[model samples]
Target chain A: MLGAMEVVSPTAPPRGARGLHRFANPGRFLRLAGRALPWVSAIGLVLVALGLVWGLFFAPADWQQGDAVRIMYVHVPAAWLASAGYMALACASAVALVWRHPLADLAAVEIAPVGAGFTAICLVTGSLWGKPMWGAFWVWDARLTSVLVLFFLYLGHIALTRAFDSPERGYRAGAILALVGVVNLPIIKFSVDWWNTLHQPASITLTGAPTMYVGMLWPLLFTALGASFIFAALVLARLSAAVMERRIRALLAARAEGT
Target chain B: MTHLAYIVPAYVSALVIPAWLAGEAWLRLRRARARLLALEGGRRR
Candidate 1:
């Protein structure tokens, strides 16, 4: 079965392995990320602006929810990014633990706080949107509860990563926590399907057509793309900072020894 | 416009949080780069 699978697979190295080898060096990553920063940031900012404007002013309001429906434009994208960011963090943690990649460790560390922020935004916006619709600001519904747990996971990862004086100790602990937290991702994704909940079922499905109309869906898609790009740019910027920090520490250590 | 209360805050929070996070990262990067340059210059002297 394995041989058959390999035969059917492309001749190229697995994309994941290829990516790991390609940017394993911090210096190489910094050079590439630095070159890409300006373009990525500019495009991200432009798309976000366009998406918000179009979503707020042009997208048709829902017949049911009226102006309140506008919240979906922001809320849905925030929720999407919160989950996506955590996935990135978990992947980075896995790489750090498995390959002992310094860049991966830093990537995981830097992503925690940003992912936490996104999760917070998602929770807050969800509450705001929920209030007008559900007649309450908070619910103990499965979906809501699982997402709350996700926010806490991000917080826990951040705290663990910074808790130890030895950075390596912190990295190992944080990576373990992140890997364990992977259980929550699927729970968050399938909560509505698995349990009774006040939260609505997903309108966008991979196997089925989106329930949203084109007008609203278009702006949502734009905002989702824009948010993703912004997330990428932020992660790259943080990664570069981390690389510089490591270099500075090494330089200081050498100077002290020499003196 | 009553719903504006909810609508405005949602959008504002979404935009502000990411913006603030990105801004913080950028500032840290700038400071780190400047410090590194200073260290390198001092070494050259």
Candidate 2:
């Protein structure tokens, strides 16, 4: 029965992973989240604190754009995660579809809105920065266009994932769509060189030296790392809540049947 | 004015959005746990 349909078999709880079994149980997950909550909150506070201080006050202004370039401290990291997040969702959705990991689809569903929010932030800030730098609030420039497409792709996934009467069916359909949209990720990345666009070439790229100075690089890097962690913490926190909601529904159903 | 005028909004949004979202998530988690505890405690009695 298990072989015919993909299922992620729960493994035996590992040694030294003691007390973590509760995370696998909804009650346990909630308890653990309460205990771990302070850590996530504290780390988030500290990371964001150090990053903003260094980014806003300590970092030197760019010779060309002066302090206006500080926007990149937020914009670039947000853009990176916007795409990176979709890729994460697509991968999780694939695993959920194929392996039938019980929590995988829930994780994907939980993350979609957050990803879309970040993508929107990236676009708005990019446009704001571009108006002065590139002379327009909007452009069909290749990079801008592709990024817009990415935003739509995120919206599409969110919609399709929740559309079906059966949550499982919605999950499967949304998973496939997410996998298909993965093709757009690379196109968004190379849009600058792939076609002439008003958006400036990448400030940081895989093949070449970053255009930013060292003083600027450190805080930006910190912000990027913190943002990624905060995203993880938020998604995990939401998933835990979702699991609890399901349990409450189950308990209520049992009571209704008993009555 | 120089680019100094733009800094306020940039820093403000950067600080506000993530902080708000994370704070909201934390609060929801807290509330859900409290509700669950009350329900579970009642169930035991």
lDDT of each: 0.84, 0.73
Each prediction's TM-score versus the true structure? 0.92, 0.85
The A-chain TM-scores of all the candidates are: 0.92, 0.85
Candidate 2: regions farther than 4 A off: A1-36
Candidate 2 per-residue C-alpha lDDT over A155-215 given as tens digits, one digit per residue, 9 for 90 to 100: 9988998899988899898899889989999998888878888877787778888887989
lDDT digits (tens) for residues A1-259 of candidate 1: 0000000111233346565666766666776788777777778778878888998999888888888888888888889989999999999999999888768999999998888888888998889988998899999999999999999999999999899999999999999999999999999999999999999999999999999999999988888888888888888888888888888898899989999
List residue ranges in candidate 1 displaced over 4 A. A1-19
DockQ scores of all models, one per candidate: 0.46, 0.37
In model 1, residue pairs whose N, Cα or C atoms come closer than 3 Å (at least 3 residues apart or on different chains), thus clashing, are none
CA lDDT, candidate 1, residue A84: 95
* Predicted model with the maximum DockQ: 1
After TM-score superposition, what is the CA distance of residue A182 in candidate 1 from its true location, in Å?
0.3
Residue A57's lDDT in candidate 2: 86
On TM-score, the leading prediction is 1
